[model samples]
Target chain A: MKLLLTGSAGFIGSHLAEHFLAHGHEVIGVDNYLSGQPRHTRHLLAHPGFSFVEADVSMGLPTDTGPLNWVLHFASPASPPHYQQHAIETLMVGAQGTQHALDLARRSGARFLLASTSEVYGDPQVHPQPEAYWGHVNPNGVRSCYDEAKRYAEAITCAYHREHGLDTRIIRIFNTYGPHMRPDDGRVVTNFINQALAGEALTVQGDGQQTRSFQYVSDLVAGIAALMALPGPHPHPVNLGTTDAITVLRFAQIVRDAIDPTLPIRFVPLAADDPRQRQPDITLARTLLGWSPQVSLTDGLTRTIAYFRALRAEQQPVPTSGPAWMRGAADAGQSAATPGD
Target chain B: MKLLLTGSAGFIGSHLAEHFLAHGHEVIGVDNYLSGQPRHTRHLLAHPGFSFVEADVSMGLPTDTGPLNWVLHFASPASPPHYQQHAIETLMVGAQGTQHALDLARRSGARFLLASTSEVYGDPQVHPQPEAYWGHVNPNGVRSCYDEAKRYAEAITCAYHREHGLDTRIIRIFNTYGPHMRPDDGRVVTNFINQALAGEALTVQGDGQQTRSFQYVSDLVAGIAALMALPGPHPHPVNLGTTDAITVLRFAQIVRDAIDPTLPIRFVPLAADDPRQRQPDITLARTLLGWSPQVSLTDGLTRTIAYFRALRAEQQPVPTSGPAWMRGAADAGQSAATPGD
Candidate 1:
């Protein structure tokens, strides 16, 4: 099968591109690199099954991208700080960008998969949000650029499916972390990991009691692939994330133990409208796609720490005068303040 | 002031256009007549202050209609049945149509007023929703086309305001009814008035216990005009409706009493995702714009009934065989089966 994947240079997108290539599918990747870094997909650039295009999907997709069986739209800034910085861009990508992808899918007779987010359920009133839950979201809040745009995207996707009989699937992704994450992405996982690696104070917000369920990137990619392989167009949205819940402090501790156990913890004020907890009820994924997250938090953190460590090593040569582990610690600390999800 | 008002042929828009014209403003009215009727604006065609442009704002605005001092985006199917029928169009008008209006506003440096609805606070958990209440909405439900579209419109309106420094105001309009409403618009006011006028049984949904605060169109127009006259951009959303809440059964009784006190009511199942109760907290509108609804329900219902009666009389020639009041009763009964709101 051939696929057109957007945001293919970002963490989740790049990983999904790799997963598709590994499964013997040809992939055409597109990214304008607004929040995505080219280095994330540098290795995949030379793969025989992968080809890349530099373009913003919000404007339009390339015309020359040949026959496609799938169109995966994951083209917006996922983290709060990034989206807040590029608020208008985020809104456009969710609205126009999704429209472009859906139009492409409709024209090519391809299955369209929208990478919707758990943020759609903003500071959710319901626990372990199910696909059936009608979210409690502020349509005009600071986070609305991302939350409302995603909601609009879902609405339009359903509209196309109902009006034009276009094949579409919506995956509401929860907190996902692993390799390829930007060190300063402003999400809790990357924030804690980078702070721990640098031996700096790990910042937890508002007593750090707020909880989240993190899904490993690989698990999310697997769920996406499974959903894509299903027989017909599944118009209903499906929750794709691990059910295992953990407090923010516990998550920070796991990262600290894996990287630097001696790192001090710092408490900070939480951002306005920050969710207290978010856990997906993925019964639909289990029943229909027969998928569940397999990566344990401990293993995921270990592999992620190894990746960051190797990244630091490559950026700074091992020093003969001081401890080799401390060579890139200073730079990591400098850039660790911008944590991402 | 020169104003570009979309949906100018619809019930509220027509009244608003007249309001602006009466205040000595030059008005350029645009409508595609999707849910709006041409007959509603027939009187305004010859008005020196008003000019009509037949175009869908969702597609694009007329370029030649120069210099807009204010852009009022009021283009969408408001009533549930009308919106549900044109679901895709409604979504596009809210998303793409809103974008077009904002772009126009930004380019012309005009104040943009978004006609958002109380449906943004979908099936509210709060009794009287305030501007501060983050809405509880279903992103993929049947009514999501209208609710989420309005939410997206608000988000994008704020986006344009923050990003381009475009002056913007959002009014969360609650249930409103008056003259020029389509007899079959499927709102409770029109529904009950039409049924009562026809001397047919008024159908009340779900024991008629659900409550909605209905604002008269003239009061909404006054509030909109006051907001438009404010000196600077007020980006905050304001709730613009009455606090006088009444149950659907009570509302039906008022309509019946005005048209025909002997009219019976039939109970029926409510529509999916219908809000059991929705009343706006207009504290912000009162403080910011000094606006409040002044039309009593009884007076509004009487005027609405008179309008429908006149319309029925015009459409069907009254026979001399029976009393003049019973002349148009047969047609009203024939078309009163479909309940609205």
Candidate 2:
């Protein structure tokens, strides 16, 4: 199968590209490197089945990439820091980029999968978000860019599916962390692992009570591939993530144990519109796609920590500003501000 | 104050333009008229304060528009029939048009008010929907074009407010009905009124018990203006709607009575993602804007019925093709059978 993967140089996209290529699929990956790294796809350059295109989907699709079997649109900034920094680009990817990719997929008669996010379920009141839970989101909040763009992206993809009958799948991805995870990625798992490896205080937000379920990248990629491969009677979004919930403080402790025994943990104010609790109810994924996160957080963090450590040993500049852990010192402390009213 | 109003030729936008003009504001109104009617604004063509430019905001801003004091972005296909006809255009207006308007608002240091919809709360689970409901939407469903685009528009508007302090105000406008509505606008008010005027069957979706509160255009405009003029503190989305909830059957009856007493009513299957219930909890509006609906549904419908009667009496041709109510019953019936997956 020939697959065209957008955002193929990002953490999850790179992993997905690698998975498809290893499984004897011809992978054509594209990225503008706005937030993604060329280094992420460096190992794949020599692979016979993998080809990379440095292009922006928001500008338009690659000129005449004819007749592909599948297009996995993983473009757009998935992390808060990257999205917040380049909001216009983030929105364009959601609106224009998704449309362009869907157009390509439609023309080629290729199946398309959009990488949506749990952020669409903004600060959800439901304990474990089912596919049905309408989220409780502040549309005017600081985090609206990432959350709403993904929502719109999902909508446009659906429009293509319904109006044009393009084979489309959407995965409402939860937080996933693993080895190739960017050092400065603001997600919790990467933040904790990096901090623990550097022998720094692991910072958890808002008294460390906010809970999240972290799915390993490998598990998420497997789910993505499976959902795409599902032949029929499957069109709605599948919630792909671990259902096991854990407090941020507990996750910090686990990371401290895995990386360094003596690293202290600290608590900071939570970010605006950040969900207090998050866990995906993966019943549909189990019933339909027969997939769930197999890698435990403990195991995932061990692999992630080793990767970050090796990268640091090579004198890779640890991100000084962008990572979630280093936003501000305790002295710059303010109460946890919710996103704007 | 110089106000830039997008979708200025559309139902709500035209009304908003008139209000601003009457208030002695210079109004620069732009609309590509994709779903809008030039007839809606024909009366205002000669107004000294009114300036009209025909352009698509999704492409970019009109070159002639000057510094705006306030930007009312009411572009996009508001009616389901219009949106379903121009899905890509609808998506573009919500995404790109919104971005263009926000960019102008940011540069002009103008307060931005995004005309979002109750559609953002797609098939909401919560009743008497507040401004906080995230919405139960099928990302891959048929109606996602409008539902998700508006959600994304609101999000990007908020990002501008947060990151750039663009003075943005978002109004989750509920179903609005009044004079100057398109004859076959596909909204319940317009649809029922048209059918009753034409002495045709008043088609109700499903069992016709699905309820919604309709706000008069004037009342909604007042609420929107008050929200835009709000000073200090609460700039998030506030529900701008009436609390008068009525079943679709009841609504059809009311239109029938208002238009022609002899018209019969019929129940058709509901459209896909047609929200089962809609009533606004306008507590935030009352607290923030000191506003509520002034026109009752009966009075509003009376006025609307009169206007549409005049419109139809003038020998206006009702569109009769796909999804058209008259001769295009085939597609309507097909849509009823398989609304959206």
Candidate 3:
């Protein structure tokens, strides 16, 4: 099968690109690198099955990508800080970018998959949000650019499916963390890992009591692949994340223990419109795809730490050789982790 | 002052254009007649201060409107039946039409007032929704094209205000009914009035217990004018409807009594995603704009009934003349009624 993957230079997108290539599928990757770094996809450049295009999906996809079996749209700024900085861009990407992707799918008769976020359920009043839950969202708040845009994206996607009978799927991705994450991306897991590696105090927002369910990147990739392979149009949004939730403070502690156990924690004010807790009710995913997150948090964190440590070593003025395991993880450019950014 | 009004041939927009013109403001009216009827603005065409342009707002505004003092975006099909029929068009008008209006405002340095709806609340989980309430909306539902589109309009309006320092105001209009409403428009007030005038059974949705706060079009026009006149960018969304609520059954009876006292009634299944109850918390409107709905329901309904009666009389084969009072109300087109469509 051949696929067109948007945001292919970003963390989750790169991982998915690699996963699909490994499965003997030819992938055409596209990214403008607004929030995505080129280094994330540098490893995949040599792969025979992968080709890359530099372009904004909001404008239009490259015309010469040939026919596609699947169009995966994952091209928006996922983190709060990044989206807030590029508010208008984020809104446009969600609205116009999704439209372009859907158009591509409709023209090619390819199944379209939209990477909708858990932020649609803004500060969710319902625990373990199901796909059936109508989200409580502030359409004009500080976070409205991302939240409302994603909501609009979902609405338009479903519109295409209903009006044109286009095969479309939406995956409401929860908190994901792993390698290829930009250190300054301002997601909790990356923040904790970076602060721990630098031997600085980890900053905990508010009381650090707010919990978030983290999904390993590999697990999310698997779930997404399974969703793409489903027959016919699946218009309903499906939740894709692990249920093994942990408090922010506990997450920081786990990162600290993996790096340096003596790292201190600093408390700070929480960002505006931040969710208190978000855990996906994956009953639909389990029933339909027979998929569940397999990687444990401990193992995921260990591999992620090794990757970040190797990155820090490479950035040093006098590069110090890291341990074989750490070097191996970094060289392979693969980790059983997820992206929280 | 010079103003540009979209959807100028529609119920609320026509009244607003006349209101602004009466207040010594020059008005350029634009409408695609998607849901708007050109006859509603026929009277205003002779007025020196009013001009009309035929164009879809979702496409673009009239280029020769000159410098705009205010851009009032009241376009899009408001009623359920019309919007659901043109679902994609409604969504595009809300998103792209809004963007075009905001761009016009930004270029001309005019204050923008978006005619948002109470539908944004989307089956409110809270009673008498305040400005601060985060709406409960199903983004992928059938009504999402309208509900989410309006929500996205608000978000983009606010985004322009915050990011570009563009002056913008949002008015969440509740159920409005008045003269010049399209009789076939599928709203409770129009449905009831038309059914009564045609000597047909009034169709009530569900148990007829669902309540809606009806605001006279004149009242809404007054509030919208007041909002546009306010200094600085008032980015917060203000509710612009009366707090006095009435059940659907009561509304139907009021119409029945005004038209034919013995009109039969029929109950039907409620439309999908219909709001159960909607009442505005207008404390902000009271404090900020010093605005309130002055027209009572009984008086408004009487005026609306007169207008519909005259319309029916005009359509008769024998051309029987309506009562002098009804003819006078229809001629003036200045009734203090509201639109439920």
Candidate 4:
């Protein structure tokens, strides 16, 4: 298969590109690095199956990325602070970026997948959100730049599928963390791991009582690989995340234990429009895709902590060399070597 | 004041352009005629203070729309049937159209207005939804092309105001019906009026028991004019809809009585994702804009019936001449002469 993946310089996207390439598929990756780290793409450039295009998908796909079998849109800044800082760009990338990617897939007669987020559930009124749940979203709030934009992206993706006979898939991803997450990305998992590794107090938002379901990146991309390979008109959105819900404080403790148990916890004010509870009911994914997360919270943390520790040890913002922990993440988590390896 | 109005050939936009022109304001009206009827602007084009630009706002605002004090973005396929028929274009217009209009406003140092809709509420969970009620919307449903698009528009509009300090206003317009509405447009008011006038059974969706609030176009334009004229950093969205909630059955009966007392109603299957109860809590509009619906249902229906009757009698689809009933809407409902006059 030939594939075009947007945001391939980012965490999930880079992982997706590697997975497809390892499966003997040709992959063309595109990104402008607005929020993505270039070092994530460094290893993939060595793979003969992977090519790179540096451009913003909001304008359009670059012309030279020849015909494709599939186009996966995984662009846009995912974290709250990053999206808020580039609100206009985030909104543009999500809406226009998704449109351009869908257009490319339509023209190429390729199946399309849009990497949406659980943020669409928006402070879930339902304990475990199903795809059937219509979200409670603020259209003009500060977080709306990301939330509303993703919703709009989902809307446009479905429009293309129904109106243009385009094959499309949407995965509402819950929190996922592993190798390649930036120390400054402001996501909770990286924040705690990096803080613990740095021997600083782990900063937890608010009371840290709010629960979240976190999926390991290997588990997430594993689900993505299965979905891309599965053939059907199976057009509905699927939830991809661990149902192993945990409180922020408890998750911070786990991270601290993995890196350094002596690290203290620092509490901070919660951001606006933050979701109180997030957990996905992966009934459809389990039944239809026959997929469930494999990586345990403990093992995933041990691996992610190693990557950040190596990152800190290398003294580069995003390490240039393919550290053993990073390679372990790319190998679908089988490798158990420590960062020193 | 000089104003640039996108969708000026649209039903609400034409009325708005006329209002501003009558107040000695120069107006540049733009439309692609995707959903807007060309005849809606026939009268406005005659005014020395008014000019027309035929272009899609989604592509970009036409280059020739001169200097302006305000830019009102009202260009999208508003009716469900029309939007569904042009689903992709509708989505494009709402997002890109809104962005282009905002960019033009930013460049020209003009205040901006976004013509959002009650549809943004998307089958409200709260009765008489306030501006603060985060809406209940289906991101992948059939109606999402319009609903999510408008929500995206609102997000970007707020982004412009917050990030760039551009003055902006958003009005969540409820169902508005008046002279310029396409006879075939699927809105309940226009549908009922045209059906009764054509001596056909009024088509009512579902059981005809669902409640909806309909605002007269004159009342709506009056609110818009007031909001645009008054000056401040007033940034929150305002509901410019009426609280005159009525059942579809009762509204159909009123339309029938106005046109032909014996006309019957034909109930039809409900639309997918249709709002069961829709009524705006317009307290914000009443206090901030000093506005309320001045046209009673009876009066508004009477005028709307006259316009459709005039349309049917003319035997031309979208009659080109500016009939008295049409002029009455432009005058903000002061003209009371019968269509025969």
lDDT of 4 by residue, B7-90 (tens): 998888888887888899999999999988777676667699998889988999865566679999999999999999998899
Per-residue lDDT for B1-341 in model 3, tens only? 99999999988998888888889999989899999987767768989999888899987876666678899999999998888778888988988899889999888878898999888999898999998988888899899989989998999898898889888899999999888788888899999988888899999999999998988888998898888888875888999999999999988988888778898889999988888998999999999999999999988888888887777765544323756776555555533341222
Q: Report the C-alpha lDDT of model 4 over A82-144, residue by residue, as the tens digit.
A: 999999999999889999999899888899999999999888898799999998888888999
Cα lDDT over the full model 3: 0.87
Task: Give the candidates in order of lDDT, highest first.
Answer: 3, 1, 4, 2
Which residue runs does candidate 2 get wrong by more than 4 Å? A207-209, A316-341, B125-127, B133-136, B228-234, B316-341
Top DockQ model: 4
In candidate 1, which residue pairs clash?
A184-A338, A185-A339, A185-A340, A186-A339, A186-A340, A187-A339, A187-A340, A187-A341, B186-B340, B186-B341
TM-scores of the candidates in the order shown: 0.90, 0.87, 0.92, 0.93
Task: Name the lDDT value of residue B28 in candidate 2.
Answer: 90
Those runs of model 4 whose alpha carbons end farther than 4 Å from true positions after fitting are A316-341, B64-66, B316-341
TM-score, chain A only, candidate 2, equals 0.91
Give the best candidate by TM-score. 4
For candidate 2, the per-residue lDDT at B58 reads 95
Give stretches of model 1 more than 4 Å off: A63-67, A317-341, B63-67, B317-341
Q: Model 2: how far is B67 from its true place, Å?
A: 2.3
